[model samples]
Target: MTTMPAPRRLLTIAVLLALTGLVATGCVRFPAPESPPPTATAGPPVLPGVQVDVPVEPLPSSEACNATLTLRPPAQMPLPRQMPPNSTMAGILERGRLIVGLDIGSNLFSFRDPITGDIQGFDVDIAHEIAGAIFGDDRRVEFQVLSSAQRIDALRDMTVDVVIKTMSITCDRLRDISFSAPYYVASQRILSFRNSNVTGPAQLADKRVCAARGTTSIGRIQAIQPRATIVSTTTWADCLVLMQQGQIDAATTDDAILAGLAAQDPWLRVVGPSLGEEFYGVGIPKGQDDMIRFVNGVLERIRATGRWQEIRDRWLSILDSGYGAPQPYYRD
Candidate 1:
């Protein structure tokens, strides 16, 4: 090698040393420039292109029974066509029309006729039968469209005489209102898209489920799948709407109601086993034992004479052809 100046030789040695040091280290490593922690999104989860907020209501207290429990009506109801004097029936008759509180959107239980513009369904038929007994005609009644949350209040405010919506008879509700004998028995069930892999409530983990706000179905859904995101709406119709929009993973309520929704849409189907027992009873104002008795009597007549079966055949035959009226359970 040719001789070099002292300063040049020192610079060359320094550069070689630096290169050797770099080679000693296997590869230049950095502490994975710390990734920014994931940020959470604001507001409740919203469906793409939808403005509605999937409101989450507080889960009912555990003191609320999770079991399938129902109140038993009197053991024996008055015979059909027999109304006690000064009873609720008298007041309703005096009013000229039985002001019945119900939602007109329930597909199977109560829905409006497209051509006739008359409300009709299983629940509507039940109300009509009661009206017929009082006035010999079912049409002598006024149908007040009440949301699910408004049913009890309407009865308490005396705005409506009775609620024939798909009201479930529950222990908590019993404290605030009276109910006739269980006219129809339906279990809490899941209604989901036909293509969904979820077979039942258990599969609802991490899923979004919709139920009518202020109804028993919401509580039951929480009990069955605490991990599920419950979206409580104002009506079962709303639940159906959300499901149709793909905003919810499922709609949960009485199988009867689910059957109604499923009937309207072939893509939707009711799945899952009975999460809890649901007793469909007519909701009456508190301290209205006379009304309870009168309504129970009407229920007995329908169940006895096969009119209940007829209504089921008419409105719910699509779900179960062999369906029969639920036997009344009387506590007294």
Candidate 2:
């Protein structure tokens, strides 16, 4: 969605041009040898390469949407490697692997294990469950890392069979893609340094707030505090880096994701009341209803077998006990 109005977009570009001229002319310079190039934004300080999304398709609204609902699971799950003929799972079986899309920078949801050089997290475990269901071997899945902005397009293009990222299901997104039953319910919140005066949403006026580009979080901030400067990054991890460097006042996103960011830095903490709830679900390509039902079947199995709790305890135990696996709901 367009992050800024037309007038503001032009002004920002002009400001950037003017700043480049100043740096080129040696009229002004950063105090340190390695500082981010000057940004034209009046809201938050942005690092080089971190960006502001120009106007695009207006973000879709979640009005009259119950993101928690998804296609019902099959009456009986087929044995692994025994996908129903002509079903989406059967196609995946023919391909010999399940392809998944997710970002590795999302900490507890998904991230690389520096020690093992492999991706692992709550989401990874869930992805494995789906793959294992189809191939009888979780490793039969091919993992593809994606930025937040790329999740839907990746699914639409069939680059991945499904996306197990920290994606929230919404009515607008459903227009282009399908989602599995809600697996996790997250709340939108803010993350700021512990000692910062910007303790909550009320204090966000004119302060620079950072969130991943093209996410619902950015739009919420834009509506909550019109004066707050919203900086868009490619991922929430980028927001964490900018916050650590004092480049931005605060970062906003789902609380579960924020908790991951907080664990990396002692100074960071989730603050203020939650903006709203985010219902996490698997992303499947639009019209892939069989795949949707199959993924829902896997999720249902996980929840019933207590594996859902196991994954949560393994990866998200650090979050306050209030957050837990969401109950599944079906559209049919």
Candidate 3:
């Protein structure tokens, strides 16, 4: 080999050593970490351009039940007003109309008259009572059919003066609106095909349950059976129709509502112990203390004069003697 300068030879040896060290150290890059595989228990999985929040535990019916179970109002609860001290009642009278938001699909609470095409039920009677108190005639009231999701928004937007759609009183709802004393007490129940093997909430695991969207029943079902699939419909009647068609394994809702459905279809039956109690109340826009008090007064008078009992008997006798008994709501 030809002789090289000492400095050039040393530089060449240094470059070769550096290259050897890099190779020995394994500096070559490797691949990135792999993402977790999709899981079956994962709820409503994420896909392209979509996101979902995990469903919450089913709400306890007991929360609403305990809130209204007592005859006395909470210490922090506001006292009922005697009457509107000014012209509010007079203004309602001048309008000659008492508009109320109600559920026409809920059988005993509010439903259509097959012959006259008019609304009728215990809730409808309550609306009529309020109208009669404001005007001298109960027939002055006009009914607007509302879905569960539409009830609160309709009241807030003044689309209706009040909501008597078998609405349950709850702290979450109190943040948005005021409620009258509970006019009816109901318990939550599960409905299934007449021969379903599912006995209770414990048995609902992996089952497909149906409920009306925006109703408390959906929350209750999810809470009890986190793994169960839920199918939501716009109305309880629609849920029942789906159940009849064998599209869903079960439906969860108030006992009164299930009772109505069972009455209509012998192929279905309600099962399990009552999930929880619920108290139905009228919803009004918050801060309308005068209107709330006026309603309380009307409710009190009706309870005292046997009119409330008569209305309940006329509509709810199908629920049995236990339901026929008078259970007066708390009124100042």
Candidate 4:
């Protein structure tokens, strides 16, 4: 009987053995994901107050549009030493005509008068005042129309005496050229069609933006909306033209420049909070202390004599009549 029962028991044991498996392994540890690159810190705080409008227009695709562009280099090559103190008007007078490198394309900072064919703007007036201080006649200025990229180089090569093209006084720029006390303050802003759904920097996620090349405005836009597609041109006017033609969704630049564009096109307006502080100053070749001092004196005189206010009122009144004239910065 014991021998007979073993056959059935053996079959049941064989079936149990076939159902067991040895494939259970211990838990695994995967490598940690790589950390992302460090991002740049935000820039300095923006200064309070708005700037005067800068006139901008659509770029006409004609030879006449190209004819208005010009580039002039700096007049006096920069020396190795820091700027010398031109503390007295007599010192500047010995040097002769005040050579000024300016942007003739920008409306309020530097632009040509359509009727008189004279280069005029707030900066232009400042340049003429410096000339008058040295030569007793504002007409003694040599105005050189220059692009943003060329302005600093022009100063380095001695092609123009000074640069007054709404040049912002930044630490990087201070390394290359000497700057006078800030005469005007501005901030970066965004310009878009009034009816557009975009309201601020956060909404620019998939938008197309335009800005002038070699300007900080582009950096600001990229910082806020890293995914945005950006287009850069040589001038703000060109950027505005592209925007107007529906080539881009937004144009970003100094608020003053944006205001100028808005004035030219009724459909556009400035949006978003100010990006960063911008202090506009005249750029002098490094080591021209004497010239720097002379220019500072002229800037002070213009503010004191109400000429600065006159220029400010003339250009800014239409956009923001409540804003008072800017205070001159004088470094002794």
Please write out the lDDT profile of model 3 over residues 102-221, one tens digit for every residue.
887787788887899888887899998888777667899878888888888888887888899878877677667778777777878888887889878887888878776667877777
Question: TM-score of every model?
Answer: 0.76, 0.83, 0.74, 0.69
Top TM-score model: 2
Better of 3 and 4 by TM-score: 3
* Lowest summed lDDT window (length 10), candidate 4: 60-69
| Runs of candidate 3 exceeding 4 Å displacement | 1-54, 57-87, 321-332
The lDDT of model 1 is 0.77
For model 1, how does the per-residue alpha-carbon lDDT over 91-201 read when each residue is reduced to its tens digit? 777778899999987887888889998788889989888898777767898989998889888988889889999887776777677778778877778998999998997
As a whole number from 0 to 100, the lDDT of residue 133 in candidate 1 is 79
* Backbone atom clashes (below 3 Å) for every candidate: 2, 0, 1, 24
Q: Which candidate should be chosen as best, given lDDT against the real structure?
A: 2
lDDT of 4 by residue, 1-332 (tens): 44648889899888766544322332344689999988888643332221112223222111222211112212442221222344434444566667788777676767787899988877887887777665667788788877776888998897888888888766566657777766676777788899998778887887878776556566556766777777766677776677766767888877777777787889998888877756677888888766666566656667678887788777765554233444543322
What C-alpha lDDT, on a 0 to 100 scale, does residue 248 get in candidate 2?
83
For candidate 4, what is the lDDT? 0.67
Q: Report the error of model 3 at residue 30, Å.
A: 76
List the candidate 1 regions with Cα displacement exceeding 4 Å: 1-85, 320-323
Misplaced by over 4 Å in model 4 are 1-96, 321-332
RMSD in Å for all candidates: 15.5, 18.2, 16.9, 19.6
